[model samples]
Target: MSNVLYEVRDGIAIITLNRPEKLNALSIELGHELAAAWERFQSGPERAAILTAAGDRAFSVGADLTDPPEIWPFAPGVGVHVDKPVVAAVNGLCVGGAFILVQFCDLCVMSETATFVYPEAKIGLTGGLITSLAARMPHKLAMEFMMVGEPMTAQRAYEAGLVNQITAPDALMDAAMDYATKLAGLAPMVLSTIKRHVAEVLPKGPSEKAGIARRDLQAVRESDDFREGTTAFREKRPPQFKGK
Candidate 1:
């Protein structure tokens, strides 16, 4: 079965991550499919899109450890730039790389049971996601998440202005679709123009930002801490991080 699913109806493109058994963990295959789905939404008749994932356990637990890690085309707000607005229907656990996807959406509707986290520090990786979180939220709160690797509840996310709305699990998709449909009714050109304008005023171009992330990621990968972290993760033990 496909790792990702895409369908368009009523001018709303719905994209779903389909790896439920893995808690919707993102693999290289899924990433490619997701990028294609975004491209289709941008080039097709759809005025807006809704991003979701299959399963009640997770929106996405992050990257799939079974597959070699590589940059996905849909790195959100970085690699894939959608001219039309997008809404995130966060149903459950949103962690690590998954939170980056949420950061890219123009609006978010998360289930009350959902949680957000960035565990890059614990895994000894860093860069764009860390910087992006700081840009999207208060510096202190962003630091708390990035540095401490703690999970943030949906209500906390709402309070921090990271998500627009929170709903019961059953109502999550309905809320997201309702919002996307409303956005779809707006003038397409106007919406596109607004999105473009916002992008233009951002501190850096997407490519430049991505380049910085790549450089930082490379440095992290070469560090001893990275090897230790990965080893500990595989061994199911706490990592011993050293400044080296």
Candidate 2:
């Protein structure tokens, strides 16, 4: 099944984390599709995007246990440079790495049922990308949220300025769409400029920088020239580089 679904309404793109059967876990397949969806949003005519999940029970429960994914796909300002405004409509559990997804968004309207969790510290595992949280919210609160590994309720998330607003589960998408619609009506160039500059102002964590570097390195690795060079070496012949 396709793990991500992209739709557009009135110039606003709606990207769904569609793995309800698995609670929209960030599996490898889902990660690739989500990355493609972000690329589409960057190049498509859509003026803004609303990121939400398929189920009301959870936006995402973090990485898939048996099949985790690289951090690039989930990254917006980091690996994926998306200038358009993005809003997160989070429902229930947004755990661990999943919380970073919400963090990268421009604004968020979370459901009252939603709770944020970062259990990496307790699990003897950690993804340093979560450090971006400090740049998003109060440093002390971000540190406590990551180090303590407790479930942050919707109200606390709002009070800490982690989330912009909180609404009923049924009203989550409506609130996100409202934000998207408003953004779509604004000047696109101005919005993109401001978004890009804001990202520059924010301090990027180590893993976040690595994610960006990975994107560049991955392109070269996947390029046709890379294949040609390898094949030529095997044949003991001069390689014809296309500069791809």
Candidate 3:
């Protein structure tokens, strides 16, 4: 079965991450498929898009540790230019790279059980996700997530204005679709123009901010601490990070 699935109906493109057993973890193939799916949505007749995942366990548990994807270590929407609105239907445990998607979506509908987390600090790397989160959320809250690496519950996300709506797990898709349909009903050209204008007026989009992030993250990746962190994670032991 395909790791990513895409379909369009009633002017809304629906994209689903299909790896439920792994909590929809993004492997290399899945990341490429997801990027392609988004491109298809943008080029197709769809006026809006809904991004979701199969299964009740997770929207995505983030990147697959066993074999990470070569794509940007952030949300697909971050570096890509998609003029149409996109809504995220977060079901459960959304963490690491997955949290980037939640941050970039135009609207977000999260399941009551869903949680958002950024564990980059724990892994000894940082950049794009941090930059994007700071842009979308309040400074203090973004710092808490990036620095502490704690999970934020759906209620907290909603209260913080990070998500548009929160609902029972069973109602997540319905709520997301409702928002996407509303967006699709608007005048397409006007909607696209407004989206473009907003992006232009914003201080920076992910693509614009990514260059610095990539450089900084590359430096981190070369650090002995990064090696220690990954090695410890794989060996199931606490990382003994030394300031190196």
Candidate 4:
């Protein structure tokens, strides 16, 4: 079965993390699939997107340690260039890398059973993307969560402005979809302009900036022109290049 599921309805894209048995862990494969899903949503006709997961256990238990993913590629504004709105519908145990995913979303709604945690400091490993949380919310609160490595309940997260709304488990999807649908009806150019401006003003973490740079490098490295240049050099001739 696919680790991610993508669907479009009512001008909104529904992207589901589909590994409930593993608590939707952000494994290496899942990260690539999720990144592709986001790219698809950005290039498609959908005006807004709702990100959610299967099962009641967790949105994700974060990374799969034994087979960790290079998560930056899936993070919004880092590797995925999405200007359309993205809404996170979180339920239960949103941990570590997972919280960063929610943190980058335009809006979020959580189930009463939901909780967010970032245990990287205690785990002795970190991607440093969590530092961007300070820009998204209060500095002290962000520091407390990342440093203390404690679970922040949905109520607390809502209070701290990390989540837009909290509802029953069954209502989580409804809440997220509501936000997506409303956003879908708004002026696309207006919404994109506001999103671009906010991204410009917002501070990014070290790893996030690195991810964007890496994505740019990866594009050029994979381009046909790069291959042509290398081949021409080997053949002792001038390279023909296409800017694409």
Candidate 2 collision pairs = none
Question: Can you write out model 2's per-residue Cα lDDT over 20-112, one digit (the tens) per residue?
Answer: 999999998888888889989998999999988998789999999889887655577666779999999999999987888988999999999
| Candidate 1: pairs in clash | none
Best by lDDT: 4
C-alpha lDDT of all candidate models, in order: 0.83, 0.90, 0.81, 0.91
Q: If ranked by TM-score, best first, what sequence of candidates would result? A: 4, 2, 1, 3
Q: State every prediction's TM-score relative to the real structure.
A: 0.82, 0.91, 0.81, 0.96
- Output the worst ten-in-a-row residue range by lDDT, candidate 4: 70-79
State the lDDT of candidate 1 residue by residue for 1-244, as single tens digits.
Answer: 9988998878799999999999999888888888778878877888989999999999999888787344435755455557899999998899887887888788999999999988888887654544656767788997898889899999999999899999999999899999999999999899889888886775563444765466467558889999999999999999999965
Give me the displacement of residue 94 in model 4, in angstroms: 0.3
Q: Highest TM-score among the candidates is held by which one?
A: 4
**Candidate 3 or 2, higher lDDT:** 2
lDDT of 4 by residue, 1-244 (tens): 9999999888789999999999999999999999999999988999999999999989999999988987789987787889999999999899989888988899999999989999998889998888888998899998999999999999999899998999999988888889998999999999999999998899988888898899889989999999999999999999999986
> Model 1, which residues run further than 4 Å from truth?
204-208, 211-244
175-242: candidate 3 lDDT, tens digit per residue: 88899999989999998898888766656645546743664566588899999999999999999999
TM-score, structure 1 vs. true = 0.82
Flag the better candidate by TM-score, 1 or 4: 4
lDDT of 1 at 197: 88
